[model samples]
Target chain A: MIALRIGLAALFLMIAVTVQTSVLTNVAVAGVTCDLTLIVVIALALSRGPEWGAIAGFMGGLLLDVVPPADHTAGRWALSLAIAGYIAGLIRRETSGSPVGPLGVALTVVLGTAVSFFIYSATGSLLHDPSVDWGEFGVRLGIAAGYDVVGAIVVIPLVMWIMGRVQPARERRRVAP
Target chain B: MLKDLGSPSRSTSSRSTAPRSAFRSAGEAPLRSAGTSRDVRRRRTVLLLVVLACFTLIVLDARRSAGSPVEPLREAAAGVFGPLESTATSARQPVDNLRDRFAEMDRLKAENEKLKKDNEDLTRELTTSDYARNRAQELDKLLKVAPAYTMTPARVIGIGSAQTFSHTVTIDAGTADGVHTDMTVLNGTGLVGRVVRTTQGTATVLLIGDRNSTVGGRLNASMALGFVSGRGEVGGTLDYKLIDPKARPKVGDRIVTWGSSGNAPYVPGVPIGVVTSVTANEGSLGSTATVKPYVDPTRIDTVGVVTGPPARAPRPQLTGKGN
Candidate 1:
């Protein structure tokens, strides 16, 4: 059963990455597109726990860092996403008694995105990546975080609902505070 | 689930043998809202291990200059996801075309009216300039702007951003199709980018708009050499800096490739863009200009990779257009 859950999470992440790279490329608003894979990892972390969150984040981020058209360093996304997932999972644990509301999810998504983008650019600059322009960092951060928060509202609940269907009935009841 | 959690026999025997078993016992607690101290310790350990692994990868990837150890991993990922991306792109293309058509309708109507007026003016100019001297000048302009090259055409399968800092596109061509790293990619309009990485079935083209991309270019009129670098936006103007400090670059000046040695990365005589504005250098030295590229890197659907440069230089044309 654990294997099945892990496999399902991996599959969901792959699909999210595929959709983000191929379909969402055309749907950019103001030259910024939301990070769908990051949201999926957050949703998985929120549904499961910190351990699963870190695992999924690492895997999804590795895929993002190495997938076709990937020109950046290999572990930048991995590091950012792992940290994001860990924090998000911690948030879930803290709010266990009360179901995390939509507003909370949106807020978490925004914070997670900003944190991850910060880590990515921070590491990028450290590595001397020429793409990290300091002048546009603030603007990119605002646009990316805002766009991801908007995407999270629609994506996070849907992922949790799908995960709930496959979960054992006892665990499902326990998960809902 | 209950057997793994409740069974004391399994946990006690395997607990000493493997840390993972201890993780399964404590970390996999499904029903417990509050985990034990052991569970928290195990979770922290897992986080630490994962973080350590990520840092290792980062250090390895960052230190490598050329021919990275991560190349095989990147290739494997591209091989696995390339077809999936292509499939998704094909499935989405029809819907995308419909949306584009709807969005293009109003813009096209205005353009059609303007084109008709421009066509009439051009027809009148064509008749008036139908002389031998004018014909030679037009032919010279064409020769100066264009040179023959063998190229392989490919369609863009995916676009990459958000995760990567650079703007790039995946084309459905690869080493199997003579696509390789550092090869120039262009469209009908002008230079698009250069191939940066390639898998068996797909190639990643780093678009000219990426801030990391810098191409050697020359002024078309005076042949002053310079470099054109991207401004990190999809439709942003390129920054052109003259190599010679005293070189004068005026607005509306055209630029072309100053071809790399062996023509590996960029070939000679490919049209780049036109100078939109000029900025004076801080000191009494080099000139700088903002150039609007002929190709819209964001909207490129089909592009050609230059396979080989022309065998010979362009010759003078004695024939007229009609003849």
Candidate 2:
């Protein structure tokens, strides 16, 4: 059962990473692209709990870091994903079913995006270019939040269904001769 | 009840052993059970490692102050995705072709009408005052100020991916076509940007209206100089410390590049934009004016890189100075 869960998580992470870097990036409305990988990590964390969530987030983030445009160093994404996963897991434990689960995922996505922007801007400021314009930053934040929320709505339920299939059956027993 | 009390110590010991047994079983459980706390811990550790990696990269990238090593990765990604982009572009080609046909037909009709009007205007000019002829001669002289600074035409290719910075655009001309870093890119009306990055056949231009873009410009009528800085949306703000607070810069006043020193980055007299609005703060020393850029960056299909003439040699110092 444990092995099966790990495999499922690994497979989901890979798909999320590939889709984010390739397809979702091209699906921008206005100038904002959806962060699909972030949504997947948050959804998984909310559904299956934190430990798995953090693991999935770490792997997803690592893959994103290594992918195209190679803007930042490797560890930046790793840390951000870990924090996002941990936060989502905490929210899951505190929330209940139905709308709350999806809501939690949405909130996690927003929080994760905010943290990313803040960290990236602070880094840019330290780097001296200081490209962070307050007005533009606020607009971009709203756009990113909107994209993530929409992504969460679609990804959460789909992920939940997949998780249901991978979950172990407690009632199954071994047959003896 | 008796059975329960009789095995109280045994029960407690068994209870303690239960968690240990569960932990041991977790190690051998099938994949479905992998969501256990132990595995979660491992994942969290990995996440931390990834974040740390990104942080290190940001720091190093900022410190280098030069081009990023990420270029190769960007190029590779562009290469892999190039085919997909081409396919998407191809799919829209038919619609584009139709649009082009309609546009060409409209342009031809406009030209026909313009020629008819020009013939009438020329007839009037011949019978009227000689002012039109004098104006033409002056225009010819004005156009002859620098005959050497011709233009090398190029096409727009792609835009940058990052949303925070939209001031950059990619062009098909590069060093091979005399497009160098800091070389000015212009359209028919005015300056667009300066080339920043270049490859064998491509270059990235930083537009004047980007938040990071700034240029030295002067009002054509007043010769009042100021530095124009981008406000990030579609316009730029001009700043000059010497300007008065109540300075009234009317709309439609042309602005032009105020050349830097001999090694100035941009050529002088390249039209930038017209003053759109002017406002003065009550206590501020200088007035602020908004200038709408001359070139519409979004619709730019073609551009030219200006390779201006070499600097003039300094005149020799006078040997016979007055005593």
Candidate 3:
């Protein structure tokens, strides 16, 4: 059962990463791409809790790091994504009722993306990457956070619904459902 | 695999040994809290180890270069994901086409109006300037003497990838297609960028509108030499220092690449942009202005990479008699 969930998470993450690198890139708003992979990691964390979230974030981040046309250090994304997962997982199963879970998911999405970009940029500067555009970085950060928040609305419930199907029936009864 | 590492069935057990409220309020507190002390310890331990592993891997990979042992894994993954990405992008092409059609028509109309005005200006100038005609005639011969380049066209696959924090476009060409770093990339209208990084099947082109980009430029009207660099905006900004700081560049002045060392990163005389505004600044350089680039860097489809020395770019219409 665990393997099945992990497999599902990995497959969805794969699709998310591919779309992120190819499709979302061209559909940028204010020069910011929708981080589909980040949203996936957040959704997965909310369903599976902190530990799994970290592991999933690691794999997703590693894939992003190795993907073609990436300009930064390989581990840069790995570290950021891992952190995002951990942060998001902090709220895993913590909220109850209708609005709370969704609010938690929304918060996770916004905070996760913002932290990931902050880490990426801060690390790049620390590494002396001159190509870092400090001027537009602030605006890009805002757009990235806001973009993920919008995507989380649909993605979070979908992931939770899928995870609900896979979990043991007694485990499902513990939550609001 | 991971769930089995911890006792999953007992955590969800309806056994009398567990408290109901622990699961009721928190949704699964017993998964962490109801378990034995060692179980909680182990769960936290696993979390720490996973995060630590990522951090350690990050440290190691950041130190490694493109030829790291993990390079093959990345390549293999790309081999799979690249095709999926291509298919998805193509499927969405028609939707993008429909959405952009009206906007594109408006742009084309504006461009047509500009071209008509330019054509009239050129005809009037050609009739009046004999010296300009002779100079152009001589320059055309000089262009003939320059090296002829072979161009391999490629389609741009992605623009402004979120994973990549740079002003670059990923093209469908790479080393396999003879594209290399520093090769000039251009579209039909004008300069786009130069190839920065290439893998087996794709290359990243760094656009001239990036803040990091620096191109030497010459004005067609005033003949003033300057450097143009990206302003981190929709267009680029031009800077002319040292030479003719006193002469203020006017609006609508055409600018072209003044050439680069051996014409590797940038070739000579490629159209960069037209001056849009010149603002006075209290400094030795005196003034600066915005430039409307010839190519729309945001929406490019087909592009060419100059694998060899490109042919000389023709001069624009000569300015009025001066200096």
Number of the top lDDT candidate: 1
Higher-scoring candidate on DockQ, 1 or 2: 1
The residue-level lDDT of candidate 3 at B96 comes to 48
Q: What's the lDDT for residue B43 in model 2?
A: 42
Model 2 per-residue lDDT tens digits across residues A1-177:
778777877777766655554345445555455766777777777766666666677767655554432333434455456567656765554442223445556677898777655554554455555445656677777888888888878887888677766665641111000
Model 1, residue B274: what's the lDDT? 89
Clashes of 3: 0
- Give the runs in model 1 whose Cα sits over 4 Å from its true position: B1-35, B95-146, B312-323
Off by over 4 Å in 2: A1-105, A151-177, B1-37, B66-94, B97-142, B145-166, B172-178, B200-202, B234-248, B259-265, B281-284, B296-302, B307-323
lDDT of 3 by residue, A87-140 (tens): 676555334222245666777888898877887777777777666767767777
> What is chain B's TM-score across the candidates, in the order shown?
0.70, 0.64, 0.65
Instruction: Give the B-chain TM-score of model 2.
Output: 0.64
How well docked is model 2, in DockQ terms? 0.22
**Each candidate: RMSD to true structure?**
8.8, 10.9, 7.7
lDDT of 1 by residue, B37-135 (tens): 456666677777777888888887876666678889999988989999888887785754566655756644454444334433432332233221334
Model 3 misplaced regions, further than 4 Å? A96-100, A168-177, B1-77, B94-138, B146-148, B161-165, B222-224, B234-248, B279-287, B310-323
**lDDT (10s digit) by residue, model 3, range B1-323:** 23453344234332322554554457655554546345445545766676577556656555655555556766676566656665666666775456566885675455545543443354334323432354565554534543345666777776665334566777777788898888888766667888877767777788887766777877766657888876545433434331567777788877766666767788665667778888877755667767888787767777777776644432221111211
Candidates 1 and 3 compared: the better one by lDDT is 1
